[model samples]
Target: MKIRKANQNDLDEILNLFTDTISEVNNRDYSPSQIKAWSSSSKDTDRWLLKIREQYFLVTEEEDCITGFASITNEGYLDTMFVHKNHQRKGIAKTLITALIDYAKENQLKEIITDGSITARPFFEKHGFKVIKKQMVNRKGIEIANYKMKKLL
Candidate 1:
């Protein structure tokens, strides 16, 4: 797999991966309605465009297809991380996250924070992130459980 910076042209693939991962992988932890509410963010084209244009967004590609993607802000906020549902446990997330962490370190960031879903919390914990709190975030009037996790760099 190769990791590279994301471009606007990657938007459709990234959004599809984001929605698919949440719908299939996260469904184990979230109810169907919650999944619908959460995955609905795929329609937020402007937000996705902003991240692709302004943040340190990266995508993992293999055989000309995007397998995973992630983004981090200058302030060390991990904005997004999604591996294709079919490509889970294939080190896609690890590679994407490692690149983001390296970017943070290179820029002298003090820490990285993210809202990790129940399905993703373990992975975050495995990477040395600690749960700051468990919070219920409302999406389309549906409350979804996630952890506010942070790792000091």
Candidate 2:
């Protein structure tokens, strides 16, 4: 697999991966309603375009197909991190996070923060992030639980 910065051309693939991962993988931890609400954000094209255009977004591709994607803001806010549902446990997420962390360190960021879903809490913890609090985020009127986590770079 190859990892590189995301471009405008990668938007659709990234959105599909994000929605699929939440619908399939996260469904184990979140209810169906929550999954639908969360995945619905994929339709927000403008928001996604801003991330791809402005953030340190990266995507992993294997055989020309996107397998995973992640992004971090200038302030070290980890806004998105998702591996294709069929590609879980294959180190895609680890590679993505490692690259994001390296970018953070190079940028002289003091820390990295993220709101991780219940299904992703363990993965974030394993990467040296600690939960600051468990918070409920409302999406489309559905309250979903996630952890506010941070890692000092």
Candidate 3:
């Protein structure tokens, strides 16, 4: 797999990956209703555009297809990290996260933060992120519980 900077052209594929992975892989941890509410298609186009345009988004590609992606805001916030369902447990997410952290370090960012889902909290914890708080985020009127985690760079 190769990691590279994401362009606007990658937005559609990234959004699809995000939706698919969340609905599939994240189902192991979240309920169906929570998944549907969290990854609702109604928010895709606009949010995808914003993430692609404003954040430092990176994609992992293999055989010309994007298999995973991570996006970090300029202020060192880890906005999103998702890997394709079929591509899970192969270190793809770790690689993408390592690249994002490296970018943060290079840019002199002081800290990195993410609102991590149950499926992702362990990964962030393994990477040295400490839980700051447990948060119940309302998505489409459904309360989704997640951890607010942070790592000092």
Candidate 4:
């Protein structure tokens, strides 16, 4: 697998990966209703596109297909990380996070933060992030619980 900066062409695939990952991999930790409300493709497409355009987006590709993606915004103040379900546990997220951290360092960012799902909290913690709080974010009137995690750069 190769990791590189994301381009506009990668947006659709990245979005699809994120949607599928949330519904499948993340479902183990989040209820179906919460997952559906939080990651609904309809609401996320525009947001994903905006992030891809405005943030430092990176993608992991294998055989010309996007396998994972990550985005850091506000000079790394916020981040969104996702890996294709089929590519999970294969170091794809590690590569994506490494790239985001490098981007943050290059930008001289003081910190990085993310609202991490239960499936992702351990990964963030393992990567030096500390939980600042447990969050209950409502999406489409459905309560979705997550952790507010931050890492000092």
Candidate 5:
């Protein structure tokens, strides 16, 4: 797999991967309604374009197919991280987070933070993020559980 910084041209593919990955991987932890609502953001062209241009967004590809993508703001806010449904647990997420962590450290950011899904919380914890709080957020009228986690660099 190959990982690189994302550009505007990668937006549509990134959104596709985002929707597919979340719908497949997050189903066990999040209800179908929640997943639908969560993945629905993939259609927000403006948001994706802004993030791709303004944030340190990266995508991992295999044979020209996007398999995973992650994005982080300059302020060390880890906005999104997702691996393809068929490619989970093969170090895709680790590679993505490692890249983001290195980027944050290089930029002298004090910490990296994210609101992690139940399925993703363990991964963040393993990467040295501590759960600052457990949150119940409503998405499209569905209450979902997640953890607000942070790692101090």
Candidate 6:
């Protein structure tokens, strides 16, 4: 798999990856309504473009298909990170996070933080992120549970 910076052309694939991974990988932990509320697959091109431009989004692809993605901010907030459901536990997430961590180090970021879903918290924990708190966040009037996790550089 090759990890590369995202371009405008990758929007559709990115959105699909996000939605599919959320539904398939998170269904075991989240309710149907919660997943729908969270992913909300309605394509908002402008919003996605903004994320692509500002978040320094990156994607990993194999056989011309996107396998995973991760994005981070200058402030070291890991805004988005997802691996295709079928590609989980294959070091994709780790590779994504490792790239972000390297970026954080180069940019002098002191730590990295993210609100991780139940399905993702364990993965982050394995990467040295500790849970700061558990939170109930509302999305589309649906309450969803998550953990605010952080890792010191």
TM-score versus the correct structure, for each prediction? 0.99, 0.99, 0.95, 0.94, 0.96, 0.97
Give all candidate RMSDs, comma-separated.
0.6, 0.5, 1.1, 1.3, 1.0, 1.0
Candidates' lDDT values, in order?
Answer: 0.95, 0.96, 0.91, 0.85, 0.91, 0.93
lDDT of 4 by residue, 48-91 (tens): 77778898888899999999888888656556788899988999
TM-score of 6: 0.97
Ten contiguous residues minimizing lDDT sum, candidate 2: 8-17
lDDT of 3 at 109: 97
What are the per-residue Cα lDDT tens digits for candidate 6 across 1-153?
899999889888889989999889899999999999999843677988988999879999999999999999999999999999889889999999999999999999999999999999989999999999999999899999999999999
lDDT, candidate 1, equals 0.95
> What's the CA RMSD of model 1 in angstroms?
0.6
Worst 10 residues of 6 by lDDT: 40-49
Misplaced by over 4 Å in model 2 are: none
Candidate 4 scores a C-alpha RMSD against the true structure in Å of 1.3
lDDT of 6: 0.93
- Summarize candidate 1's per-residue lDDT along 74-108 as a digit string, tens digits: 99999999999889999999998899999999999
Query: What pairs collide in candidate 6?
Result: none
For model 3, the stretches where C-alpha displacement exceeds 4 angstroms are: none
Clashing pairs counted in every model: 0, 0, 0, 0, 0, 0
Q: Flag regions of model 4 displaced more than 4 Å.
A: 41-44
Cα lDDT of model 3 by residue, 4-48, tens digit = 989889877887888899988889889999999999853658778
Candidate 4 vs 5: which has more lDDT: 5
- Predicted structure with the largest lDDT when compared to the true one: 2
Better of 1 and 6 by lDDT: 1
